[model samples]
Target: MLRLPGFRVASPTTIAEAVAALAEPGARPIAGGTDLLPNLKHRLGAPTVLVQLSRLPLRDVEVRAGALCIGAGAVLADLAEHPLVRAHAPSLARAAGLVAGPTLRNLGTLGGNLHLDTRCRYVNQTPLWREALGGCLKSHGDRCHVVPGGQTCVAALSSDCAPALVALDATLTLHGPAGARTVALADYYCADGTAHTGRAAGELATEIRVPLAPGPRRETYVKWTVRKSIDFPLISIAMRFDLADDAVAAPIVAARVVVGALASTPKLVRKLDALRGQRLDDPATADAIAAQVGAQCKPLPNLPYDADYRRAVLPVHVRRGIAALVAAGENHG
Candidate 1:
């Protein structure tokens, strides 16, 4: 049985108070606790103080101006059921609904999901198991188990919300003891999985703002995992497309393909630009673009799936996402 290390728990009612608590040494903020609690049990993470942000009124979903503002503490179940989220950012809603189970979805917050710790098969194990293997690069060792002689950590970013938000071009608002700042969602993750998040130690993600599209944009999220439930994605793809009136000349814009769970950060395969000016009806062009995307991804051997298998499925996800978007466009027309 995994045991949680002893720590002081503090619930702050205001964002300011929470920020102050997080500024202290060995202090960490907790929202939902779905991700943090398990890490604590595994001895992967420990803090002298746990600052709970549940009391901070950061759980509202509202349409502000032309953007949808989702509070950081908003639960997954709430976001999944939100009308605006369902209509404007259905990919995000779909990803949230598929996270964990009904009970966890009711408690896990968007911020928690966005800031989910990177995972590695070798790292996410019991202390005894990890100790037996001489620890991993992400934990107590200096060498990466995934890449052998590689100097960098090769842990996989398994967050479901990240790719969905990246596809929508969302912006994140972060607050800290110093002040607040906003950044594009794409900039929130780094290339190194060990230090995947670009957020400062004292900063807390306060909200996520997704700008509304002028016309309805079609989007879909497809995740390939080892299991049907409670399993993190082995390879997740989120694709968004803006359609043209003709539906034959071009898409007006091509789909933004964000591939997750295969790399340190969700990767946007810009090579799919081949589809920008082509109609989805052209099977040859679509297949060519899918082939380009498949070649761009380099999955490593870390997660539950084999690297080659994940690489092979990239085209499948791209094809499925594009097909769904095209069908949605046709329905709208």
Candidate 2:
């Protein structure tokens, strides 16, 4: 049986104490332990001490200053059902409900999911399995199995909620010994798979804030995975379109599409200005946008799924997601 390496635990009741504890050498912060514990059992990392943040007061979900503020320690299950989230950020709620499974969602925190480690088929194996393969870029070897001879790790970021949050223009609030700072969720991820996120060492994410939409809005999150439940996405897509009014034929005033489970950072599809002023009810509009996604996205063999298959079906999912969103809007209108 796989076992976690020996480690001491520190439970801090205050955010200040939690930040100070995380500043210690070989210390790691943990809340739900859903993601971190599995990696620990796989011998992926062995922190000397675990700084427990469950007791900290960072589990509130409320509206403040026209933005929905969600604490980092808020449970994923709670977020999935929270009225504020369901009403203001339904795409995020759907994505949260779709993470892992019902049991893991009950135990996982939003912070844990947001900072989930980059995953690769090669690196997520047992220590013995990895050792026999001579290791890969993320597992202490110089080479990358996915890219062969590539210097950088190409592990995929498989967070379901990340792309949805990015599409909603969310911001993250981080606290550290220095102080607190807020960063746009879109700007938070980097290209490097080994250290994909911009969160600095000795820092802790406290909350995430999503700005309230200025006008009518419709959004959806869709993903393709090996299984309907408990499997990470092979292709994840989140789309947000602000409408001119709450009418069945409202034109899109702004649009943002983010695709995840591809690389270290979610790909925000660019050149979407053409989507502006297009009505969601128009079938041609969906076809044009899906074509753009298909052209811009090129899936890698970072996960266990076939890259070519993922690439071929990427646009199909986009077109279907648009259709579903349009149908939902029509029903509500």
User: Which candidate's TM-score is highest?
Assistant: 2
- Kindly list the per-residue Cα lDDT of model 1 for residues 64-135, writing each as its tens digit: 989999999999999988898988899999999888888988889999999888898888888889889888
RMSD of each: 1.9, 1.2
In candidate 2, which residue pairs get closer than 3 Å at backbone N, Cα or C atoms, i.e. clash? Answer: none
Query: Tens-digit lDDT track for model 2 on 1-333?
Result: 768899999999998898899989999998899888999999998899999988989999999999999999999999999999998999999899999999999988898889999999998889989999998888968888898779888799999999999999999999999999999999999988889998887999999999998988888899888899999899899999999998757988999999999989989999899888889889988888899999999899889889999999999999999988877865531
lDDT of 2 at 158: 91
> What residue runs in model 2 are displaced by over 4 Å at the alpha carbon?
331-333
At residue 1, candidate 2 shows an lDDT of: 78
Model 1 scores worst on lDDT over the 10 consecutive residues at 245-254
What's model 1's lDDT at 37? 92
User: What ranges in model 1 sit over 4 Å off?
Assistant: 246-250, 328-333
